[model samples]
Target chain A: MYYALQILIPLGLLMLGWGVGTLLERAHYRRIHRREDQHHHVPVTTERQLWNPDLPIAESRLVRGQVVVSVDYFKRFLAALRTLFGGEIHSYSSLLDRGRREAILRMREQFPHADVILNLRFETSTISAGGGRAMGTIEVLAYGTGVRYAQALRPPAVPDPAAD
Target chain B: MITTNIETVPGRTILEHYGIVQGSTIRAKHVGRDIAAGLKNLVGGELRGYTELLQEARDEAFSRMVDQAQEMGANAVVNVRFATSSVTSGASEILCYGTAVLVE
Candidate 1:
């Protein structure tokens, strides 16, 4: 039973990982697409200077977003096998793309009304588990300064409804 | 206080500046969070617990830096920068620094 148990456990785990991981990734992508469409008006830029050098700014503040993603069991095993061939690992590419896009979306979500975001930066790090060669998890960080024009933050001059 | 990573604030001018101010915090996740994160590894998705933990730690560091800037009588902190490192197996350190300044 020992050898049977050993062989069956990994096989079961691989199946479970593939089934659930794909579902989660698909749901995450759907949510990301919807939110990205919702926030189209907010602009983002990596330029150090303000988009409009002379634009009046009533408020400017720092904002950031962060994400941490781990590879599923099936992908990790696949990556381990991939090392033998020494080629591009498509799984990791998508993993990193998701992390980066999610991080940026969260950053944009922080300031839905931001006129522009400037000096954008990113920081990524990997956390290895159990001293394994396979990457265990990756964290993506995105930061920037959000700018609001002089009147951007002000309430409309509409007369109060109570007064009406 | 307003914080920006760039040398200039959009509509404000720097009148005076105080040298670099810094804040640092070291944090570790609790056992419950660690266990939850481990389970997430099976299917490879976001580790929400760790995300929240790190976010809290970073916010703490940012606030501490802002407090220092306020104590220095500065209205803004510019050219802000952040760095992080894993000090130990489970604990991480977050560092935030910026130049404090009075802007008009």
Candidate 2:
């Protein structure tokens, strides 16, 4: 009975972790997609120069957002197995995508008035709480300069003939 | 104070350069948060606790860098950069640096 209990416990835990992990990942991806669609109008770019060079700059400030994501036990196990074979770890790809997208979304949400974000940069690192053997937490940080255009200098849609 | 990752602040003139100012902070995760993150790892999603932790650390580092700029009597910090690395199993360090400048 003792031996049977030990074998069953780990198996049960693995199964539970797998089920919950999949559900959470799906939900997170759904949220990320919805938010991305909502903020599609906000232009986020890595260009060193401003998107609209003609627009007069009113204010520019630094903005940043960060996200930390962890790999599930089941995925980690799979990743370990894949490591031995030395191939692409598909599970980790989604994990990184979620972190990066979430970080950018948070930064975008912070500055509604900004015309665009320029010089965007991303930094990622791993945080392992336990021994090196365990899967570590991954952190993604997205930062950029939020440039707000001068409202007073906004160009008119049509030329004013009377002024001319 | 004006802070930007860009090398120059648009529409502003830089008068004086104050060299590079930097700040860093190392943080360790609490047991409770670790356990929560562990559970989160099972499903594989965003770990809010760790996210908030890192955000706070970043903010602190930025503020410290700004304070250094203020000490140097600069009005802005340009070409700002951020980095992170794990010091140990649970602890990580957040570092921020920038070139301090007096702008008009």
lDDT per residue, candidate 1, A80-113, as tens digits?
Answer: 8998999998877778988988999999888877
Tens-place lDDT digits, model 1, residues B1-104? 88998898778889998889999999876788767878899998899987888788889999999999999999999988888897766777899999999998
Candidate 1 CAPRI category: medium
C-alpha local distance difference test of each model: 0.84, 0.85
Query: Worst 10-residue stretch by lDDT in candidate 2 chain B?
Result: B37-46
Relative to the unseen true structure, what is the C-alpha lDDT of residue A88 in candidate 1, on a scale of 0 to 100?
91
TM-score of chain B of each: 0.97, 0.97
Q: Candidate 2, A100: how far from true, in Å? A: 0.6
Q: Which CAPRI quality tier does the interface of model 2 achieve?
A: medium
* Model-by-model DockQ, in order: 0.60, 0.75
Per-prediction TM-score, please? 0.91, 0.90
Candidate 1 reaches a DockQ of 0.60
